[model samples]
Target: MTKIGKKATLLAASALCLTGTNAVAEDAQTQAELDALRARVEALETNRAGPANGDFRIGNTTLDVYGYVKADFFYDFEFDQGDTAFVNVIGEPSAATDGTFGATIRQSRIGLRTSTPSGIGEIGGQLELDLFASNGTAELRLRHANITIGDRWLIGQYWTNFQPLDTYPTSVEFNGPVGIAFARVPQVRYTANLGSNTVFSTSIEENVSGSNSDDPVLTAAAEYNNGTYIARASALYGNAQTIDGATEVDQWGVTLSGSIRPWAGGLFQVNYIHGQALGPYLIGLGDAIVGGEANDVDGYTVEFRQDLSDKWNVGIAYGREDYDLATSTGTLAFTELETIHVNAFYKATDNLTLSAEYIYGERNDVNSGQDFDGNRIQVAAQLNF
Candidate 1:
């Protein structure tokens, strides 16, 4: 290609990267338009990070509306876990039908984000909601409602600071594979950038598990990212008390997680967490305390993803959790949990994706004396904007 042609291609890529948008290719585009777009991209690139790049602008603030319309269809081969693949519920067979089919649009969500420049730096806010509030019904549930100041301070509800949010496994199921820390809570957090690729942060977060306690959770995290690889370490501690003020214990956890790009279109993600009185962070829905003592819990997840082509990709993930109960007064105490997902995705367009996945899960009860398993297959279509 000629020098002019090569420059045009680079100009287009810069435009897309700056705006975070996918633009349709045009056959009759002129050189003058490309030159103008390149100028805009260059200006934005020269500015500091976290600049508002949304298509809509009101005064100094830029607004972006995002989210996806997702529909999922699944069939349980052994036991039903509802629209969500909550495999931990698998239990001894009963009159409940084994082979059941279900579908839902509850995973669909919408969010609005806005950012404006300030003398201190930049101010931003986000409000996000989804339709998964009620079981078996689509009700709007709040996902994120937060404000950020100067890209360093965050206040309000968001993903818990301790979760490895970036390294979560990719799956067609809304719930994904479990055995990982996952929670959303209100908090005030401050972050310090060590350089272009490293950051340290701390927060005092609301203790959702401490209904009877008067203190907030303290969390700290450090992360390093250089485009091709990522690593993070996080720790949290707080006082938790059981309802009726029967028992109060120290609730704490530590997490190590990372993602690596091993080859072109190939990625690997792994995470490990160990804690006591984990609360809702453990998606297994287990109690933070059992029999007047904090439960010791450990969980991990690993996944690999490979791209077959520009339009197709596949991923496989395994997750597990083990519990050490200080006291077990019944035979139904859960001792272990495991789950797996094998999934494939095809992008029909820049904004639409179709996917299919197979899910398998197991739970061990009463000191691993009894085991239950569940199998299911799922397919989904998602349209993002």
Candidate 2:
């Protein structure tokens, strides 16, 4: 062979070898990528079977569990009811007997919450239950079952929009005060933030006490908060029908509530509600609309709390509800309800608290010139989880 031919042949062989080596390396890289993908698929399948962390998950949804365990021990000096005082009943002659001692865990509760991502917003739901049930038995009862679509809307059972939650006073009793507006009902609510400090909310809630009228109760509220202070005004309107279906009464109420921090570790809260037929919303103290005529009612509550130290606090609260009866007979049936609470709380740990409270309640029947009074002392231990 000529010298030029020999050199060309040698270069051609080197090129072929290089091309073969490149092909082998490419094949090995492809196999490594396939192995990585397969391992990732297996890991995801394992995770789908159960949650690796504390929270449960399914697809894009995440579920969390939470609640508290509480035990309350109480002694009644002027009433016999073993549970929290129902002022309306405790004021009756039948309940005037004294010397009752009781203990219960009925307030302990468990709840489940879930959040899932969606196209419009995050969908969230909660299911909560406690041991308060029918016939004074220790059975699970639903407290809240509701769903929220982002921050704007909510559906199902939740705290009524007509009340200000921030103004609620701390107390050992399950039913804190007589004059506080409290109710949880099935409803559809819309909430909007007007600015950094103002919020407006409205809802249409199911009226369990409305007689013949099928229309739901309407509620609206506006709240303003500026670091140390919060103020709110809420209103409700509904129709109540008599059981006979012969009479329909107009029911409505307006509530103004606020909380202010006067100094470091000191706070004050006040609330006032006045309207016609506010029985169901005002701790069931009286009939909203009694007889054929609607009852006009007024309620007021005031509370002050002072933090003594990082682990100790003291509070005092007073509440009253008064009703106006058009007929003399109605006056005898329902008249006035009032309550006072003084409490001290100690934080045993970050998740544990111990508290003691003295509660005094009174009721009066104006027509009969009869007054019933009750007093109770309660101690409670609560552990949060």
For model 1, residues 1-385, the per-residue Cα lDDT tens digits are: 4333344457688665654432344523444566678776555444323323764556678777789999999998887888888866676444136599999999999999988999988999999999998757799999999999997999999988998888989989987887888788999999999998999999999987533567899999999989789999999999778887878899899999999999999999899999988845776766777788888888989999999999999999999888887223233457788999999999999999999999999877685577878899999999996
Best by lDDT: 1
**Residue-level error in angstroms, candidate 1, position 74:** 0.5
Clashes in each model (backbone N, CA, C under 3 Å)?
A: 0, 2
Q: How close is candidate 2 to the true structure, as a TM-score?
A: 0.83
> Which lDDT value does model 1 have at 299?
92
Least well predicted 10-residue stretch by lDDT in candidate 2: 45-54
User: What value of lDDT does candidate 2 attain over all alpha carbons?
Assistant: 0.80
Instruction: Estimate, for each residue in 1-385, the C-alpha lDDT of model 2 and write its tens digit.
Output: 4332333345455545655666666877655655565564444444432342324456778777679999999988887656776666655556656587899999999999988879979899999999999787889999999999999999999999997898887788898888878888899999999998999999999875433457899999999999789999999998877677677888898999999999999999999999987766786456655667888888999999999999999999998988886223222465778889999999999989999999988877765678778888999999986
